[model samples]
Target: MYVYRSHDQQLLNERVAQFRDQTRRYLDGQLSDDEFLPLRLQNGLYIQRYAPMLRVSVPYGMLSSTQLRALARVARQWDKGYCHVSTRQNIQYNWPALEDVPDILAALADVEMHAIQTSGNCIRNVTTDEFAGINGKEIEDPRPWCEIIRQWATFNPEFAYLPRKFKIAVNAVPDEDPALIGVHDIGVQVLQRDGETGFRVLAGGGLGRTPMTGEVIGEFVPWPDLLAYLEAILRVYNKYGNRDNKYKARIKILVKALGAEKFRALTEAEFAELKDGPMTLTAEEVDAMRSHFSAPAYDAIDDQPPALQDALASDKAFNRWYHTNVTRHRQAGYAAVTLTLKKTGRAPGDITDEELEAVADLADQFSFGEARTTHQQNMVLGDVRQDQLFTLWQRLDALGFATPNLKLLTDLVACPGGDFCSLANAKSLPIAEEIQRHFEDMDYLHDLGPIDVNISGCMNACGHHHIGHIGILGVDKKGREYYQITLGGRGDKTSRIGEKLGPSFDTEQVVPIIARLIDLYVEQRQPGEQFIDTYERLGIDPFKERAYATDH
Candidate 1:
C-alpha cells in the first residue's frame, strides 16, 4: 500500500477545511440549496431517500490497517454502526446526518483519506483489479499508473465537471481483465512492447440506460505520452459530449454518435498536439510512482506448504473456501484470499464496525497490515501465507466473512435500491436476498458452477447488471415493484451487454423465474459447462420459454 506524502496529507486537510466552511455556510442560510448541491456532491455527500449518504474514497481499493481502523471508528462514531462497500471500490455510510458530514470528512483526513471526486459530474475514482500486485499473471502492478492518473485528474480545472460523470480503469493482466475496463469511460491495458512499458487505450465505454464496451483508440501509446493521450480523449469528450439531456450526456453516447473510427481519429489529432506537452510522463516520474508500491520481502519456500494440503483434507468447509476464495499469488508460499461479503440476508457489502475491525486485525496478522477491496463487493488480503490458510479461514469464519462463494450464483452483486436511494424505482436489496436464500446450499451452488448475478435498482446501472451472466433490473409497473431479467452478460476481457428475456416479472415472481432459468441451464448444459457458456451456445430461447411460463 502507498503511504500518503506530506503534500497528499496537506491537500486532504485543506479539502476538509474548505468543505467544513461550505457546510457551515449552507446551514447558516448563507448559501442556497442550489449553490450547495454541487459543492456537497464534489465532496461525496448525497441526500438519499432517507438521510444523507457519504461516500468515502478508497483509492484503487488499497487500504492500510490504520486506514481501516479509522474507517471503523468513523462508522461507529458519526454514522450508523456499519458501512457499505460500493461496486466502484468505495465505501458509503448510508445514515449520516447532514451537519456531521464535514466532521466525518475531518476524521477521514486524519488518516490520510478523503471523499474528493467520489461523486458529481467529474472524473470518479480510478479503479483497477483488486489483485493487481499479487496476481501471478499480471504484467506489472497497475496501481502506480492508477495513482498517477488519480493525481492528474483530481480537481483538474479542465475536468471538474463534464457532460456527465466519467470513469477510468486499467488492466495489466494479459490473459484476463478483472477490472471491468470495458465498461469505463477510459480503459487502459498496460503492455510491454520491446522492453518498454506502454499502454493500449480505449474510450467511450460505460453502463446506464446506454451500455457500451469501450473501443480501442490507441493500440500502443508510449508511457511518456500516456497522460497527454488521456487529456486528448477527455478534451474530445468535454468539447463534443451531449450537454442538452442528462440521459444522453455520457461519453458512451458521444462514442455512438460519432463512430469509433471517427472518435479515434479525433483523439489522435488532439494527441498529436499535446504529446510533447508538460504533462508527458517522464522516466523519473514513473519510477517515483513505482517506488510508492515496492514489493514486500518474502521467505524462500515452495508454492504450497505441506500443512495446507493436510488441513484441506481434514476440513470440508475449509477446502471449499480454499478452492473458491484463494487465488495464486506472485510469490511462492503466499496466497491472495477474497473474503466474500455476499452472505445471505445481510445487505451485500455491508459490514458492521466490529466486523470491519476484525477484518482489519486479520489483515494486520495475515496480510502485512494491508488489504484491498474488490469491484465485486469483497475484501481481499493479498499476502496471506499458504501455511496459515486454515487459521485465517477460522478467523474469517468468526468474523462472518467466510462465505466460500466467490463467483458462485448466490454471490450476487446488488446496489442499495429503493431502500436507500430516492432515484430507485424498486427495491433491489430484498430481491438479491430472496435469490440468495433460494440458493443458499453450498453444494448446489458449487455444482451449478461459476455465474454472475447482478441486480440494479434502476437504469443508473450502479449494480452493473449489464455485465452479469444473470442480470436483474428493478422496474416500476403500475406503482408496484417489478424486475426485468437479462442473460449471457459478462465483464471480463470479452465484455458485452446482456440480452433481455421478454416481459418483466413482479417482485414475488423474480425468485421462481430465476430458479426456472437456472434449472433450465442445469438440464440443457453440456458436460462441465457453466451457465454462461450454455446460454451463449444455445441462445436465450430455452431459458426465455421456461422463465416466462405462466403456468408457474
Candidate 2:
C-alpha cells in the first residue's frame, strides 16, 4: 500500500476540518439545504431514502492493515456495524447520521483516506485491477498512474463541477482485466512499444441510461503526454456535454451526438495546446511515484507445498475454494486470493466490522499487511504464499469469508437498490438473493462455468447491468416492481451493450425466469462454452423463447 506523504496527509486533515465547519453550519441552519447540497456531496454524503449514505474513497482499491482497522473502527462507531463495497471500489455506509458524517470523514482522514471527490460532478475515485502489482498477467503496475491521476484531479478548480460526474479507469493489461477499463468516462490502456511507454486513451465511454464503450482518441500518447491527452478529452467534454438535461449530461451522450471522429478532432485540437504544458508527466516524477508502489520483500517457498497438497487431498471443500478463489501471482510460489464477500444469506458486498478487522489481521499474518478491494465487490490478498493458504482458508472459513463460488452464477454483483437508495425503482437485493437461493448447488454452478449475473435497482446501472452476461434491471411498471432482462452484455476488451429479451416480468417471476434461462444454457451449450460464449453462439432467441414459455 502507498503511504501518504506530509503534504497529502495535511491536505486530508485540513479538508476534514473544512467539511466539519460546513456540516456545522448546515445543521445550525446557517446554510440552506440547497446551499449545502454541493458541500455535503463533495464530502461524499448523500441523503438517501431513509438515511444518509457516506461513500468513502479507497483509491485504486488499495488498503493497508492500519487503514482497514481504521475503517472497521469507523463502521463500528458511526455506521450500522457493516459497510457495503461499491462497484467502483469504494466503501459505503448506508446508515450514517447526517451530523456524525463529519466524524466519519475525520476518522478516514486519520488513516490517509477521505471522501473528497467521491460524489458531485468531479473526477471520482480512480480505480484499476485489484491484482495490479502481484498478477503475472499485467504489463505494468497501473497503481502509480492511478495515484498520479488521483492527485492531479483531486480538487482541480476547472473540473470541480462538470456537465455531469466524470470517471476514469486504467488497466495495465486490458486483455486480462477487460471489464475494469472499458466502462469508464475516460479509459486508458498502458502499453510499452519498444522500450518507450505510452497509453491508448479512450473517451466518452459510460453507462446509466445510455451505455456506450469509449472511442479511442489517441492510439499511442507517449507517457510524457498522458496527462495532457486526458485533459484535452475532459476539456472537450466540458465544452460540449449537454447541461440542459441531466439525462443527457454524461460524456457518453456527447460522444454519441457528435460522432467519434468529430469528438476525437475536438479533443486533438485541445491537445495541441497542452502537449508540452506543465501537466506533462516527467520521467523523474513518474519514477518517484512508482517507488511508492514497489513490491514487498517476498520470502521464497515451493509452488505446490506438500502441506497444501495434503490439505487439498483431505478436504474437498477446501479444494473447491482453492480452485475457484485462488489466482497466479507474478512471483513464483506466491498466489493472489480472492475473499468472496457474497455469502448466501448476506448482501453481496456487505462486510461486518469483526470480519473486516479479521481481514486486516489476516493481511498482517499472511499477505504483506495489505489487501486490495475488487470492482466486483470482493477483496484480494495480493501476496499469499501457497503453503500458508490452507491455514489462511481455515481462519477465513471460520469467519465465513472463504466461499468457493468465484466466477460462478452464485457470485453476483448488485447494488443497494430500493432497500436504501431513493433513486431505485425496485429492490435489487431480494432479486439477487432469490437467484442465489434458487441455484445454491455447487456442482450445478461449477458445471455451468463462469458467468456474471448483475442486478441494478434501476437504469442508473450502479451494479453495471450494462456489462453483465445476464443483466437484470428493475423497473416500475405503473406502481408495481418489475425486472427487465437483457442478454449478451460484456464489459471486456471486446465490449458490447446488452439487448432486451422482451417484456419486463413481475417481481415474483424473476427467479423462475432466471432458472429457465440457466436451464436452457445447460441443455444447449457446447463442450467447454461459458454462458456468454454460448449466448453469443445461440443468440437470445432460444433463451428468450424458453424463459418466457407458458409452462415456465
Candidate 3:
C-alpha cells in the first residue's frame, strides 16, 4: 500500500473539516434537503430506505490491515456492526448518522483511504483485478495504471459534471478476470506485444437500461498516450452524450446512436491532436508509477509444505476450504486465499464487525499486512505462504469467514435491492437465499462446477446480472415480485450478454426455475464441461426449453 504525501494528507484533512462543517449546517437546517443532495452524494452519503448509507472507497480493492481494523472500528461504533461489499469493490455501511459520516471519513483518511468520488456520477472507483500482481498468467500488475487513472479522474474539472456516471476498469492479463474490457464506459486492457506494452482501448460499453459490450476503438494505444487517449474519449462523451433523459444519458447510448464506426472516428479525430500533448503518459512517468507497485519480497521456501499436507489429510473441513478457497500464486511457495462472504442464510457480502477484525488480524499474520476485496464480493489474502494455508483456513472457519464455496451457486453476487435501494423494484437478498437453500449439497455444486449466478434488484445491473452464467434480474409485474432469468451470459475474455428465457417467474418459482436450468445443463453437458463452456457449446435454447417445461 502507498502512503500519501504531506500535501495529499493536508488536502484530505481540509476536505474532512469542510465536510464536517457542511454536515453541521445541514443538520442545523441551514441547508435544505434539495440543496444538500449533491453535496452529500459527492461525499458518498446516500439516504437509503431505512437510514443513511455511507460508501467507503477501497482504492482498487486494496486495503492494509490497519485500514481494515479502522473499518471494523467504524462499523462497531458509528453504524451497525456489519458492512456490505459492493460490486465495484467498495464497502457500504447501511446505517450511519449524517453527523458521524465525517468522523468515518476522517478515520479512513488516516489510513490513506476516503469516500471521495465513490458516488455522484463522476469517475467512480477505478477497479482492477483483485489478483493483479499475484496471478501467474498476468502480464503486468494493473494496479499502478489504475492508480494513475484514479488520480487523473478524481475531481477532474471537465468530467465531474458529466451527463451520467462513468466507470473504467483495467486488466493487465489476457484472461480479463476484472472483465475490464467488457461493459465499462471505458474498458482498458493492458497488453504486451512485439516487445512493447500498451493498452487496448474499448469505448462506450455499459449495463443499465441498455446493455452493450464496448467496441475496440484503439487496438494498440501506446503506453505513452494512455492519459491523452482517455482525455480525448471523455471529451467526446462530454460534448455529445445525451443530457435530456437520465435513462439515455450514458455514453453507451451515444455510442449506440452514432454506431461504433462513427464513434471510433470521432474519438480518433479527438485523439489526433492530443496524442503527444500535455497529458501524454511518458515512459519515465509510467516507470515511476510502476515502481510504486513492485512485487513484495518473499523469502525462499519449499513449494509443498509437509505440515499443510498432514492437516489436509486429517481435517475434512479444512481440506474442503483449502481446495475451494485457495488459488495458485505466481510466487512458487505462496497461495492467494479467498475469504468467502457467503455463509448460509447470511446476506451475500455482509461481514460483521467481529469478522472484519478477525480478517484484519489474519491479514497481518498471513498476508503481509495487506488484503484485497474482489468484485465478486469476497475478501482475499493474496500472499499467504502455502504452509500456512491450513492454519488460516481453521482461523477463518472459526470466525465464520470460511465458506467452502467459491464460484458455486451459493457464492452469489447480488445488489442491495428494494430492501435498501430506492431504485430496486424487488428484493435480491431473498432470491439469493432461496437459491442457496435449493443448492446446499457440496457434491451437487461441485458437479455443476464454476457457475456464476448473479442477481440484480433491477435493470441497473449493479450486481452484474447481465454477465452471470445464469443471470437473474428482478422485475416488478403489476406490483408482484418477479424474476427474469437469462442464460449463457459470461464476463470473461469471450464476453457475451445473457439472453432472456421466456416469461418472468414469481418469487417462489425463481429458485425452482434456476434448479431446472442447472439440471438441464447437467443433463446436456459433455463430460467435464463448465457451465459457461457448455452454454457456449450449446446455446440457450436447450436450457430455456427445460427451464420452462411443463413436466412438473
Candidate 4:
C-alpha cells in the first residue's frame, strides 16, 4: 500500500478534525439534519433504514495486513463484529452510531484509508480486477493509473457536485473481470496497439431505472495522456450532463441523448485544451506510482506440489476446492485462492472479525502478506504456494470461509437491500437466502454450472444484475415485492446486456421460476456446456418458454 507524505497526512488529519467537530454539532442539534446531510455523506456516514451505515473506502480494494487488522479492530470496537464487502470492492458497517463515525474515520486514516468519495454523486472508489498486477494475461498493471485517478478525483472541485453518482472501472487484461464497463459512468480498459499501451475509454454506461451500455469515446488514449483525457470527459459531463431530473442526470443519459459521436466530439474539444496541463500523467510520474505496486518476492517451488496432489488424491473436499476456488497464477508455483463468503446459509460477502484476523494471518503466512477483494464480493489470497493450499483450506474452513462454490449457482451476489439500504425497494438478502436453500444440492449446482445469479433489491444494479448469467431484479408492484428475470447476460470477454424474460413474478413464484429456467437449460444444453454458453447457443426462447409455463 502507498504511504501518505507528511503534507498529505496533515491534510487528512485536519479533515478528520473537521469531521469530528461537524459530528459533534450535528448530535448537539447545532446543525440541522439538512445542513449536516452533505457533511455526513462526505465523511461516508449514511442514515440507513434502521441505523447509520458507514462505508469505508478500500481504494482500488488493495489492503495491507496492517490495514486489514485496523479494519478488524474498527469492526470490533465501533460497529458490528463483522463487515459486508460491497460490490464496489469497499467495506460497509451497517450499525454504527452517528456520533462514533468520526472516531471510525480517524482510525481508518491512521492506516492511510478514508471514506472520501465512497458515497454521494462523486467518483466512488475506482475499481479494477482483483487479479490486477498478478494476472498472467495483463498488458500492464492498471493500479498506478487507478491511483493517479484516485488522487485527481479526490475532492475534485468541479466534479464533486455532479448530477448523479459516478463510477469508473479499469481492467488491464483482455478479459473483463468487473463486467459491463460499457455501463459505468466511465469504463476504461488498458489496451496495447502495436507496441504502445493506453486506454480504450467508454463513457455514459449505467444501470438503474434506465440501463444503457457506455459508448467508446476514445478508442486508444496513449498512456501519457490518461488524466488529460479523463479531465476532458469529466468537463463535458459537468458542463452539459443532465441536472433537471435526478433520475435522468447520469452521464449515461447524456450519452444516449447526444449520441456517441456528438459526445466524442465534445470530449475531444475539451481534451485539446488541457493536453499538457498539471493533471497530465507523465511516464516518470506513472513509473513512480508503479513502484508502490511491484510484485512481492517469492521463493521458487515446483509448479505441481506433491503435497497438494496427495491431498487431492485423498480428500474429495480438497479436490472440490482445488477445482473451484483455486485459479492459476502468473508464477509457476503459486495460485490465487478465492475465499468464498457464500457459505450455504451465511450472507454473501459478510466477514466476521475473527475471519478477518485469520485471513490476515493466512496472507502473511502463505500469500505474500497481501489479499484482494473481488468485484463479485469475495476475497482472494493471491500468491499462495500450491504446497500450502491444504493448510490454508483447513484454516479457512475452521474460520467458516471455506465455501467451494465459486462461480456456481448458489454463489449469488446480492445487495444489502431493505435490511440496511434506505433506497432498496425490497429485501434482497432473504431472496438470496431463499435461492440458496432452494438449491442446496451440490450435485445440482455443479450440474447447473457457472451460473451468475445476481440480484438487486431495485434497478440501481448495485448487485450488477444487468450482467448476470441469470439476472433477478426486484420490483415493487403495489407495495408487494416482485421479481423480473433476465437471461443471457454475461460480463466477461463477450459482454452483453441481458434480455428481459417477460412479465415479473411475485415473490413466492420467483425461486421456482428460476429453478424451472435452469431445468430448461439443462434439458436443452449440449453436453458439458455452461449456462451462459447454453444460453448463447440456444437463445432465450427455450428458457423463457419453460420459465413462464403454467405447470412451473
Candidate 5:
C-alpha cells in the first residue's frame, strides 16, 4: 500500500475543512441545494432512498489494517453498525446522517483514506485485480501504475466533470483479466515487448442501459507516454461526449457514435501534440511509485508444505474451502484467500463493524497487516502462508467468512438496490438471497460449476449484470417489480454482453425461473463443463425455451 506523504495528508485535511464549511453552509441555507449537490457528490456523499450513503475509496482495492480499523470505528460511531463493500472495491456506509459525513471523511483521512471522486462525473477510483501484485501470471505489478494514474486523475482540472462518470481499470495478467478492464471507460493492459514496457489501451467500454465492451484505441502506448495518451483520450471524450442527454452522455456512446477508428484517430492526433509534454513519466518517477510498494519479506520455503498437505488430506471442510476460496500466489509458500461476503441471508458485501475489526486482526496476524477488497464484494488476505491455511480457515469459519463458494452460483454479485439506492427500480437483495437459499447445498453448488450470477436493480448495471453468465436485471413494469434474465455473458479474457432470454418475470417468479434455468443447465452440460461453457455451446435458445416453458 502507498503511504501518504505530508502533501497528501495536507490535501486531505484541506478538502475535509472545505467540505465541512460547504456542508454547514448548506444546512444553514447559505448554500442552495443545487450549489451543494456537486460539492457533496465530489466528496462521495449521496442522498439515497433513505439516508446519505458515503463511499470511501480503496485505491486498487488496497487497505491497511489501520485503515480497516478506522472504517470499523466510523461505522460504529457515525453510521450503521455495518458497511457495504461496493463492486468497485469501495466501501459504503448506507445509513450515515447527512450532517456527519464530513466527520466521517475526517476520520477516514486520519487513516489515509478518503472518498474523493468516488461519485462525481470524474475518473473514479482506479481499480485493478484484487491480487494485482500477488497473481502468479502477472507480467508486472499493475498497482504502481494504478497509483500513478490515481495521482494524475484525482482532481485533474480538465476532467473534474465530464459528460458522465468515467472509470478506468488496469490488467497485467496475460491469460486472464480478473480486473474486468474490458468494461471500463478506459482499460489498460500492462505489457512488455522486446525488453520495452508499454501498454495496450482500450476506450469506451462501459455497462449501463447502453452496455458495450471497450475497443482498442492505442495498440501500444509507450510507458513514458501513458498519461499523455490517457489525456488525449479524455480530451476527445470531454470535447465530443453528449452533454444533452444524461442517458447518452457516456464515452461509450461517444465512441459508438464516432466509431472506434475515428476515435482512435482523434486520440492519436491529440497524443502527437502532447507526446513529450510534462505529463510524460520518467524512470525516476516510476521507480519512486514502485518504491511505495516494495515486496514483503518472505521465508524461503516450498509450497504445499507437510502441514498444508496434512490439513488437505485430513479435513474435508478445509479442503473444500481451500479449493474454493483460496488462489495461488506469486510467492511460493503464500496464498490469497477470499473471505466471502455472499453468505446466505446476508446482503451480499455487507460486513458488520465487528467483522471489519476481525478482518483487520486477520490481516495483522496473517497477511502482513494488509487486506484487499475484491470486485466480487469479498475481502482478501493476500499474503497468507500455505502452512497456516487450516488455522486461517478456522478463524474465518468462526467469523462466518469461510463460505467455500467462490465463483459458485451462491457467490453472486449484486448491488444495494431499492433498499438503499433511490435510482433502483426494484429491490435486488431479496432476489439474491432467494437464489442463495435455493442453492444452499454446497455439493449441488460445486457440481453446478463456476457461474457468475450478477443482479442489477436497474439499467445502471452496478451489479455488472451484463457480464454475468446468468444475468438478472430488475425492471419496472407498470409499477410492478419484474426481472429480465440474460444468458452467455462473461467478463473475462473474452468479454461479451449477455443476450436476453424472453419477457420479464415478476418477483415471486424469479427464484423458480432461476431454478429452472439451473436445472436445464445441469441436464444439458457435457462432461466436466462449466455453466458458461455449456451456455456458449448451446446458446440462448435451449435455455430460453426451457426457462419460459409452462409446468405440465
Candidate 6:
C-alpha cells in the first residue's frame, strides 16, 4: 500500500475542510441545488432513491487494514451497519445523511482515503488487476503506474469536467484482461519488448446504453511519454465529445462516431504538441512510485507444504474453499485468497461492519496488513501463506466469507439497484439473490464450471452485465419489472459484449429461465466444457430457444 506523503496528507485535509464548508452552505440553504450539485458530486456524495449515497475511492482497489477499519467505522456510525462494494472496486454507503458526508470524508482522510473523482463527469478511479503486484504472469507491477495516473488525474484542472464520466484500467499481465481493460474508456496494457518498457493504449471502450470494446489508439506508447500520451487522448475526447446529450456523451460514442482511425490521428496530432513536454515521466519518478509498492519480506517455504496437503486431505470443506477461493501468487508459499461477498440471502457485494472489522483483523494476521477490493465485488487477501490456508478458511467461514463460489454462477456481480439507486429501472438485488438461491448446489455449480453472472438494474451497466458469461439486466415494462438476458459475453482476454435473448421476463420468471439456460448447457456441453465454451460453440440460438421455451 502507498503511504501518503506530507503533501498528500495536506491535500486531502484541505479538500475535506473545503467540502465540509460546501456541505454546510448547502444545508443552510446558502447554495442552490444547481450550485451544490456539482460540488457534492465532486466530493462523492449523491442523492440516491432514499438517502444520500457516499462513494469512497479505493485507489486501484488497494486498502490497508487501517483503511478497512476506517470504512467499518463509517458504516457503523454514519450509514447502515453494512456497506456495498461497487463493480468498480469502490465502496458505497447507501444511507448517509447529506450533512454527514463531509464528516465521513474527513474520517476517510484520516486513513489516507477520499472520494474525490469517484463520481461526476471526470476521470474516475484508475482500476487495475487486484493481483497486480503479486501475479506471476505480469510484465510489470501496474500499481506504481496506476498511482502515477491517479496523481495526475486527480484535481487536474484540464479535465475536471469531461463530457461524461471516464474510466481507465491498467493490465500488466500478458494475454489476460483480468482488470476488464477492454471495456474501459482508456485501457493501458503494460508491455515490455527489447528490454524496454512501453504501453499499448486502447481507447473508446465502454458499456451502458452503447456497449463496445476499445480500439488500440497507440500501438506502442513509450514509458517516458505515458502521461503526455494519456493527456492527448483526453484532449481529443474533451474537444469533440457530445455535451448536448448525456446519453451519447461517453468517449465510446465519440470514438465510434469519428472512427478509430480518425480518432487515432487526432490523438497523434495532440501527442505531437505535448510529447516530451513537462508531463513526460522520468525514470526517477517511476521508481519513486514503485518504492511505495515494494514487495513484502516473504518467508522461504515450499509452495505445497506438508501441513497444507494434510489439511486438504483431511477436511473436504477446507479443500473446496481452497481450490475455489485461493489463487496462485507470484511468491512461492503465498497465495491470494478472495473473501466471497456473494452469499445467498444477502445482496451481492454487501459486507457488514462486523465483517469488515473481522476482515481487517484477518488481513493484519495473514496478508501483512494489506488487502484489495476486486472489480468483481469481493475482498482479496493478496499475500496469505500457503501453510495457514486451513486456519484462514475456518476464520473466513465463521465470518460467512467462505462461500466457495469464485467465478461460479452463484458468485455474481450486481449493483444496488432500485432499492438504493434512483437511476435504476428495477430492483437488481432481488434478482441476484434469486439467482444465487437457485444455484446453491455446490457439486452442481462445480460441475457446471467457472461462469460469470452479472446483473444490473438498468442500462447503466454498473454491474457490468455486458461482460458476464450470462448477463441479466433489469428493465421496466409498463411500470412492471422485467429482466432481459444475454449469453456468451465474457471479460477475459476474449472480451465481448453479450448477445441478448429475446423478450424480457417478469421477476418470478427470471430464476426458472436461468435454470432452463443452465439445463441446456448441462445437456449439450461436452466433457470439460464450461458454460461459456458451450454457449460459444453452439451460439445464442440454442440457449435463447431453450430459455424462452414454454415448458421452462
Distance from true position, residue 215, model 2, in Å? 0.5
- Cα lDDT tens digits for candidate 1, 168-188: 999999967789888899999
Worst 10 residues of 1 by lDDT: 488-497
Q: Deviation in angstroms for 201 in model 4?
A: 0.6
Instruction: Return the candidate ranking by lDDT, descending.
Output: 5, 6, 1, 2, 3, 4
- Comparing candidate 2 with candidate 4, which one achieves the higher lDDT? 2
Question: 1 or 2, which is superior by lDDT?
Answer: 1
Clashing pairs in 2: none
Q: Positional deviation of 105 in candidate 1, in angstroms? A: 0.9
Stretch of 10 with least lDDT, candidate 2: 174-183
Give the poorly placed runs of model 2, Cα more than 4 Å off. Answer: none
Off by over 4 Å in 4: 175-180
RMSD of 5: 0.8
Clash pairs (backbone) in predicted model 6: none
Cα lDDT of model 5 by residue, 21-73, tens digit: 99999999999988888888988999999898899999999999999999999
Q: What's the lDDT for all of these models? A: 0.91, 0.88, 0.86, 0.85, 0.93, 0.92
* TM-score of each model, paired residue for residue: 0.99, 0.98, 0.97, 0.97, 0.99, 0.99
| Tens digits of per-residue lDDT for model 2, 374-474 | 88899989999888999999998998888899878888999999999999999999898899999898888888988888899998999888888899999
C-alpha lDDT of residue 412 in model 6: 94
lDDT of 4 by residue, 1-552 (tens): 566778667878888899999988988999999998877787678899989989998877888787788889988998789998988889989888887888898998898888887888788889888877878888888888889898888878888888888999887888654534666789999999888888999998887878778889999998888889998999899888889998999999999899999999999999998887776777888888889888788778888888989999999988888899999888888999998888666678898887788889888998877888877889999889899999999988888777788989888999988777888888788889999999988777777779998899987888888888999898888998888998877776645688999999888888899888888888888988888988889888888888877864
The total number of steric clashes, by the backbone 3 Å criterion, in model 6 comes to 0
CA lDDT of 19 in candidate 1? Answer: 93
Q: How big is the RMSD of model 6?
A: 0.9
Q: Give the clash count for each candidate.
A: 0, 0, 0, 3, 0, 0
lDDT for position 223 in model 1: 93
